[model samples]
Target: MGDASRPRFMGAALAGEAGSSRPSLESGHHSYPSFDNNSSVYALNPEHGGTESRTGSQYFNYRDDPNDVPMQPLGDSRYLDEKRATYAAPRQRSRAKMILAGVAAGVIALIIIVVVAVYFGVVKKNDNDKSTNNDSASKPSGTSGSGGKGSSSNLVVTGGDGSKVTTDNGTTFTYQNSFGGYWYWDPNDPFNNGAKAQSWTPALNETFNWGVDKIYGVNLGGWLVTEPFIVPSLYEKYPKAVDEWTLSEAMAADTANGGLSQLEDHYKTFITEEDFAQIAGAGLNFVRIPLPYWAIETRGDEPYLAKVCWTYFLKAIRWARKYGIRINLDLHSLPGSQNEWNHSGRMNDVNFLNGPMGIANAQRSLDYIRIIAEFISQDQYKDVVVMFGITNEPEEAIFGLDNLQRYYLQAYNNVRLASGIGEGKGPMISYHDAFLPLTQWAGFMSGADRIMLDDHPYICFGGQSAAPISSYATTPCKTWGANMNTSMSAFGMTAAGEFSNAVTDCGKWLNGVGLGARYDGTFAGSTAVGDCDTWTNWPAWDDTMKSGIKQFALASMDALQNWFFWTWKIGNSTETGKVESPAWSYQLGLQNGWMPTDPRQAAGVCGNTAPWDPPLAPSATGGSGAGQIPASVSNSLHWPPTTISNVGGGATDLPTYTPTGAVPTLSAETFSSASGTGTINAGNGWANSKDTAGAMVAIATCSYLDPWVGQGIAPPSPLCSGGARRRDVPLPLITPPPSPS
Candidate 1:
């Protein structure tokens, strides 16, 4: 068996070795009687990833068999009605008896007071200051324009209706800074070895063309994603959290248990505007934002479950645009767990592909994509969002290729239609390989012009995790070089969607338990050997390793059309040290001087892949076209000479057309329970019972005093107090009810 301590690719031998039955991909659907229909809204016990206890030496797949929910037949109005009824309708206070009604009224009154106080004293007062700061922070970046460069002040915001408005009035921005300071594009530095006196514009900022530009990017992991291993401190603080799904549930419980204010504060501070500035400064031109389906909302649960994160998602998009960075919006998790991994927001289920529920779940997943596509299609974000990744790291071994392909086709059409592809303005659609052989997708989306494949090739997991650090770093480039050379031939345009230098599998820190160092004593045991900084040979060995790996990274840039490093940053509380930080963190790698300080280095590799092949033009068979040097136009200007270098040779030409499309205006509650119907049902079951008397009182108590609870403010005496005995009180007064008569 492979090292159980690392990530084992399940599609390879594990299914058969474990004697797990393979359900027919083209067969009848089975109803899962034992499945918990209410699991989506309620917290299940923490025994996810199955009952098989994990040993330290075990290679961890982080997948468990899905608990299949019974699927309702489509167009069955009765079943739909029943499901709708199951959604816990907010109980009307008037429906209760007079005694309960009076109590509810009091609770409502108290809630208003608290909200008024907080809104005025906290939210309102700070809102303006935060807004001002955010605007000022975002404004220092350049304006969007063509030519070697344009003044940030001169850029104008063109309205969707083609009306122009200058940003000087504090209306909108049109440009952001391009590469000019670093050695790659710097015209001033004496030590500069590369091209200067030129401008470089990102291909993503132009039209949606895969032919001329190769994608060079980085993943924004652990920012929106609450991965236990990546942000170990979060998990360590909550003992029951085995994964993101579990952690979310625990946080929900904490909020319900009178910790709402703390939860709100957490979301406010987790990932701020500064992170975006730093990402832009690092010279990475793109970011892959891995977000869960719940970032919008999952109607069946408490608000905290969804957590009002849509605002943050929008904030991230704006920030990316402000900094001249493109975004690849990735739906990392689906309604029903797409894969059994914790990153899927559920660890025990591949519900997306299981039995009858699979179709329903697939439809739900499509709804999320459509909504996001609609948002990106708007005038402001159309070009900024370069790729709309449908899903991330799905396991086809359980989901089945037929189902995956079917959903991809449906989803592709939906996105194109919603984003108005006919107008020549839509982002590229990216789909994950799902552990299947890449050859299977040869000419998969041939009819579609801007579809691509997403593959995650990591050295820190599976069999590679056990390999020596040098072999881990140097050997993969051979496969990458060969694969990148043929990417267009095999799949339209392929990219390494998620990858990192980590070469170890230490996860004990997630549980707040310390495991002995996996490498030399100075490095964190959880860090991969490839990223470790404590070599016995000291600085010389460090320099050699960095150089070798840097070359390898450049080789990868040459091989693959585009690549995003696995992560930008891990939580500070979770980072062991600069060198021993989460090995996948690109920021830590930069701090340690292992990563390139300039984005132009990627262009350098694009210009020539020496060890692999002399710069050969892409094959004529594929849609690969020689890059065009951008010509000066009214809105468009010439980018620096070093931005894109044509491999295989051709005349310099710039793509003139900038893709534009209409942003969708969706109805309210786009994914809310009230709007849910047809195949887009929220989930299988809802709250089956009405609110109990205790539940009603508790709800009132929470609605009024939960914030106070989080703020350490005790509710007045008996009723609002945690675990305090409730006194039988008459309506409208705090005095005890006639001694309970």
Candidate 2:
């Protein structure tokens, strides 16, 4: 009976009272359906956590043979033809509070009323300030590496394949920025007084009816950026850690650093399955996981980090499945300095796909995908997960388009031919942008059916064009985190990878939206620029955007795209507003992009208008196969909800658009006949049955969508024709993945 409210950071504090159904560590992410026949592919991430990070190449849990799909642990090997339903990660927990059980059978009904009141009171307190606060634009005055000051003692993390840690008892543990690893920071003002930690709740959003095709779909990063380690037993019981033991720093920190642990505390936890489950029930679908290649390939024959980290990963996956959420596997860092940092786990040059390490990494990525596909693809979740992304955000200089294309294409082929794919195989691919020219996307790689193009959009390059809510449907080009219209061809998710209101708005403009990329395409430095002569304040609603949320909601629903806001949360950064402008980018996320719950904030995004109730999200797809894109055509990927939908009616349901928290949910449709003009999926994004014929072109990347579709809460028109225009340059007549390869 808890009243609904606005979106928030991991509702870690919501764990006090919860449901009784104890979820399996694996079941914490998503509950899978029954599957008997299959081979290899151990469908769980825990086994990998145990093997990838602890054991070595020869240490997987599963075995060869498709028949082993259902029982396979996590290892390298193949299997033959086999059939099964599918598998999904279980639901992880959240931070929301729970209702007390049976106050009194006689007063049970009355207790329900009291529970509702209490829920609102707690939620209101958290949301009130959040709902209506900000006035002037405020710059971030952060805490710097001063946080990393040397402590009186050192904490050693051992056991569970180094999954164990020894804290200085309760001594002052200091973690400098260097401890976490080097990343980009403005030099002049390179220190602050604010570090951030997160309260991770497993994804429980209702996103079954849709998914992603282009990399623009919503996804959060930094998973492997830094690891947090704390009370293991608590996390061991976390519903999110279902089968595998994935590691995250956000869940293991204290409140001082905004609940963040020093970088050295790395991957430990004290969470419960109940905590993760609440998260799943709350509605945050999809967890963009960034794992270091070392967890599974460091010593090849002796992968040391897996036993623990990989195991955690499995636990997370299962919980996500139980909650019916999707997972986006991202190799955030590479063997060598993929982007000049320690995030990839080391600060060296690791040629992921073109060197000895490349082979190792490729095999690591491939084998991982193979295991997952073989094990879970046949189960009930076969159609839910989209693809296994090759790497996170890599520079074209290191991971060149041609080379990347070659490497990924090779990987894709391996996946297709590996077996256990049955008649329906999702896809395996990779993504990169900001470094390559947007105009040159067509010139990149293409071969796999799930060839997804990713780009990072930041506003550092230009001026901020102000427009009204209605203007969002047409004006404000599609470039990442700048002013935009929902219907414009330039505002799609895939067209403009990630966005952050981080630098630009501080907690200012982004009480809602995010930021990103450039004009000619290719990576440039951060898009941090000077702000207009406007006053900004604390983390309250930006005057313009607060009311604008409704407008933003309308546009995203119209398009249906998914996106990972720039960040989920950020650690303490001594350097604040240090960007030199015209080349700055703010990290998206309050701590990572979730904020505190406030009464007022909750009122606007929650209550009756909110869609977090049970049956909140229903299946929207209806087996007409998937939609299609023009054959042998290379479409120029860009931003804007309307633009993508118009150009390609392909996975129009793909979550290529951005996430708008307060919109109404959609339903699905079952097609009895393929002979109608336009179909109405009774609910969700299903192919409107009762259709006779109206063109069913198949988009090569079958997994992607219109970009807008995934972001929409309600059903949308595949074509919003708000601003259709002529192409300025020639587009690639790109071809789809080779049949079956």
Candidate 3:
């Protein structure tokens, strides 16, 4: 765990640049003890190392692809310039002081009148003058339509066919559940004025047969109802503000006038029917849209927040119907962000689980869920894929089995009673595990009516470390400390109330050494193609392209065909895989350890480097970073405009990549390579570009999502403790690349 294990310098493959100050994998280090081939439990732990990714999350990473994205390079530094564009209020005298001036009553009245006039002037001036000022401010970074400045309100991801989101290699992707999905098509678009554009079915398939194809869904943050607060002006600085400001207090006088428009724009941009359609088409049948507790609570006396969410819910249901995408309403944030910052929206820099403030937030969250389930379920969208997440990744009881069970019990009852989802519509909920014994813990918190055991197996920061998949059975250090299935059996976790986990992003883990491959099964993996480091440059096509995706097809057929792999991909924010862990191949920023490849940097690109030894590599395998990406390259793509500011440490270290409104493109060389013999085959996991007969088809990922389970906050079904005890399916020998013809 010492910094010595990591190199003092980084082995970055800059396009043409020379050496720089990077840490090493084997510098002044505590040499890692060799792993006993017989499984003596590898000891390279991430918890006690030089880790930068903070406890919850301190820095926000930005990237192009939605995989384990390297910390986003400080993109453009101009982000801060778009600060709260507040209006300087017109100078006014204090009413108290003026009244006590010992003047005639009429004089006092005159003073009051003058003060009123000045106040009005400030308000009016802010409204009227904003046009010119805002125009310039909004236009500063371009992406504007008119020469005049554009409103930040209108700058959301618009409704258009963004199908070409990827045309290149994934150097990276995280969070922010957009409860704001499926709202793009104007129920009254001039294009479909009288078509009843908003009509859709809300009936969810409630036939609860265990092990049936249960509807699946994920949450996207919908800040539409909350974006007004996006203007930092509305929020007190998180964590350290002397006093927090409420919505009304922040927008009380001047900002309130345009609040409605701001709110509308926020919702408008949060979701689009087209986005839903894209997801639906991707095979995703359901969607869990998470709305925040704040959304329901209004600042004024009109505090019934339930009605507002219902208003939004129906709108969402109609849109999903249009796209054939089902919907499940998920409550992501409590009063604060839940399950780390990934999408909960609260700054992910701190532990929100048991923090005093986090608890109060949890209660408010329960209050909000009860409100939503109470009204929405009784209406038309009853069958909609709706459910309640008692809390997203509540970890207070993670270390304590009893606490975990008790907390969930409270969650179960709270949601059930409040939503009136009585008995059957058991909600699906997940809990984060303590770094302790997952198997032993799994049994302690078993569930009943529709309870699901959600486990987030992380390997990046102080999360779970990776051992051979087989270790799940033979190791005490791994999941439940025993066989995975056996543990699940004990906790009553069987089919139906199955388990799920977000695994390593595609290329984040293929660090094998001693082979070369390409999209066309070319002999590219040959050492002639350079060492392991050169492998990182494996054209995206060459990866699965080898032998026409026999391996990908084999793996997918093997993996997806089974009941595991909850979420297929992870952006940088998931923090589950080991990329920067010195306790890993090397440490922070991959300073030392050989540069074989950062699987996280390139998701699924398999690196044929030597065995990945802890605390650094034994030798400099040429395959170092061969097919994976480096932080330097990763520091490029800036997607959400905010990525610009996330980099550059606020300004001084800003980036130079000007994200031309142009969608980033992939090279034809990268695109044209193919391993398939022009056939469509899902069996091989390689789909065809054009749905031809023999080749498998490439489908949009979200196309697989569904949203039709109408369960109330369900209890955790019989627990599977931690999947630690699950039996590790043995890795079958890969068919050897056929001998040379």
Against the true structure, whose lDDT is highest? 1
Could you tell me the lDDT of residue 703 within candidate 3? 20
Indicate whether candidate 2 or candidate 3 has the larger lDDT. 2
Q: Candidate 3 residues 324-361, lDDT tens each?
A: 35444555445434322323333222223232222223
lDDT of 2 at 86: 70
* Candidate 1 TM-score to native: 0.55
Stretches of candidate 2 above 4 Å error?
A: 1-220, 227-266, 270-283, 300-307, 337-342, 347-350, 353-386, 418-422, 426-451, 460-477, 480-497, 503-560, 571-741
lDDT by residue (192-229, candidate 1, tens digit) is 11111112333222332353444557887765766655
| TM-scores for every candidate against the unseen true structure | 0.55, 0.39, 0.37
Candidate 1, poorest ten consecutive residues by summed lDDT: 687-696
Q: Against the true structure, candidate 1 has what lDDT?
A: 0.45
Error of 3 at 486 (Å): 5.3
Position 167, candidate 3: lDDT: 12
Candidate 3 Cα outliers beyond 4 Å, as residue runs: 1-210, 214-218, 221-266, 298-313, 322-324, 336-345, 348-362, 397-404, 418-423, 426-447, 458-488, 492-741
- What is the C-alpha lDDT profile of model 2 across 182-280, one tens digit per residue? 111111112110111111211111112222211222343333344211112222323242111122332343346433233223343322222233232
Predicted structure 2, TM vs. truth: 0.39
Determine the C-alpha RMSD for candidate 3 after optimal superposition of all C-alphas: 29.5
Best TM-score among the predictions, by candidate number: 1
**Quick one: ranking by TM-score, best first?**
1, 2, 3
